[model samples]
Target: MANKDWKTFMIPYEQAVEELKVKLRAIRTEYRRKNDYSPIEFITGRVKEISSMLEKANKFEIPHDRLAMELEDIAGIRIMCQFVDDIETVVNILRSRQDMKILYEKDYITNVKPSGYRSYHMIIQYPVNMASGVVNIIAEIQIRTLAMNFWAVTEHSLNYKYKQSIPENIKSKLKEAAESAYQLDQTMLDIKDEIKDAQKLFEVKSAIVSSIMNDILYLMSLNKIQEASRFQSQLNKLIEYGDVSDLNQLHLLVRKEINRFR
Candidate 1:
């Protein structure tokens, strides 16, 4: 009974949120295609106020303004990225846009509010054209890494459920978790170069081995057993070095083993 009544009140504000999300998605898609950014991780939206609904009554009286936003996310969008650095690149793209007016800027990453919260947030006002009419919606953009998002979602759920009055000990634990996530972000960026190099080397070695084996089989098919056998030994010598560009030192050692194998 309460849920049904809440929906009637929440519907107009909810429509505003849904419309904002559609606009954000269109903007993001345009940027990605224009800039050649592919394999995007995630894009999501939320309208806030899970506990209550917004109605004409929810609209404030007096100097607060009646048509003004009261919900946390009068409109909201979350942009998730693979790399921590990607978050800034995303924020910058939006910042440069003329259509989106920045109402507020909060750098939770650098200036964490001591609530163990971390994200880059921008409160923006953009004119959204809806079937009903054109409305100016205040949208909040949260940019963060997937790891940060995971921690935040957990923290938010706990906060809402417990009314944000978590025990002191638990609050300390949440701070530790946030710090850990920060460390993990730094470490991943540091190791990314090495990881990419290793993956490339692994792929190159696999392709070379397959090519060598095919060559050896072709020699055998032509009845050149001696040639095929010698080439097979040479291929074995090459195998140990994998995809190494400088394999001369390893080549010396492998050649000795290759002769023995033959």
Candidate 2:
């Protein structure tokens, strides 16, 4: 296809990536709103560049007319997790979703590549609405822990620098780094519950503090200066030494303080 034609052809894939990123990020927001720990750390997405796509097509002997059929990763979404166990949670979440249907899955975490590349990959068919009509397209979603993603990025950079002919010493170093990353993920999983509790406590404290400050400002806005000051003092005390780890506890305390003002 001509350059203009290729650009036009790529618009759908670009849309797919952008839409998928937003949808995936909403999952994280939902978890935070519920005061729960999310398995997904972050999400990123990209549509394959034309040059890179052409290169892969040639390498894989894909014909020009069959690029869409052969290139499963034309649209890519990456989901990063904090713990190794989180990867499974994310995968299960995707599997349970009805909006996107999974075409297949590759469990490279259980079957690591020889170059120490490890990630769980899912090929899903997503429907994208275009001006012409709704079209079903294949998008690849990759799930990996933070450590695993870090190692993968470093290794990818090295591979590009060496043109995929990395020297033996550098390859060995990459392998060692991958192993260290795996261990780090494992360690995080060991203290997962403790980490989760700490995170929840922090979220609760922040929410309560914010709500109290907002309420004080509202009082001041209504020219209730004395009431605002008194509430501010109470809020300061709570911030200084509040053992609140849940929303209900914070709400009860704040309610009592507000009742005193009344």
Candidate 3:
């Protein structure tokens, strides 16, 4: 393809990556807004560079005309989770979504790659409305725990550095690291409930603090300088050594002050 043609070909894939990132991030935001535990810790996406796409095409013996159909990962999204079990929750959520059609799935977590890579992969067909018309594109989604992502990223860097011919000693070390990462994930899963409870408490305290600060700001806006100053002093003390109950009490006091000013 010509240079201009290649640029044009990538437009929809770029759009697909941005749109998917926004939609997936929204899911995380929605969970936080409702004070629920979110399976997705974060999301990232990218469209394949022209040089990399060409290299892959040449390696796989794919024709330029068939690139869109054969290259499943030209546009990719990665979802990172805090625990191993959260991967399943995210996969089920994607399965139930109506916006994209799932083409198939690859469960490397269960199967275990020879290189010890672990992740859940899904290929989906997503439609993008262009000025000319709508085009359906293939995109790949990978869900994995933070440990797994770390291992994968390190492995990828080494592969690039060594030109995919890593020394056997290095390969063995990589395998051991992969197992260690998996063990860490398993341990985290065992204590998931305790971790979640702690996180919830922190979030509740944060919400109360936010409410108190907002009320103080409102008092200032209403020109109740003395009331706002009093609350601010109390808040400074609470921030240093206060529990949720203390913060809640302060929040209530600030709210009452704001109401009185009104």
RMSD in angstroms, all models?
9.4, 2.7, 1.3
Q: Is candidate 1 or candidate 2 better by TM-score?
A: 2
For each candidate in turn, the TM-score is: 0.61, 0.88, 0.96
Cα-lDDT of candidate 2: 0.87
Q: Rank the candidates by TM-score, best first.
A: 3, 2, 1
Candidate 2 lDDT, tens digit per residue, 86-162? 89899999999988999999999999999888999999999999999988889999999888999999988998899
Among residues 3 or more apart in sequence or in different chains, the pairs in candidate 1 whose N, CA or C atoms overlap within 3 Å are none
Off by over 4 Å in 1: 1-40, 49-67, 70-72, 194-262
* Top lDDT model: 3
Q: Which residue runs of candidate 2 sit more than 4 Å off their true CA positions?
A: 224-242, 245-262
lDDT digits (tens) for residues 33-113 of candidate 1: 564442235788766563332442334431224324644455577888766777888788788988778888899988886
lDDT of each: 0.68, 0.87, 0.95
lDDT of 1: 0.68
How many residue pairs collide in each prediction? 0, 0, 0
Give the better candidate number (1 or 2) by lDDT: 2
Candidate 3, residues 143-224, lDDT tens digits: the string is 9999999999999999999988989999999999999999999999999999999999989887888888888888999999
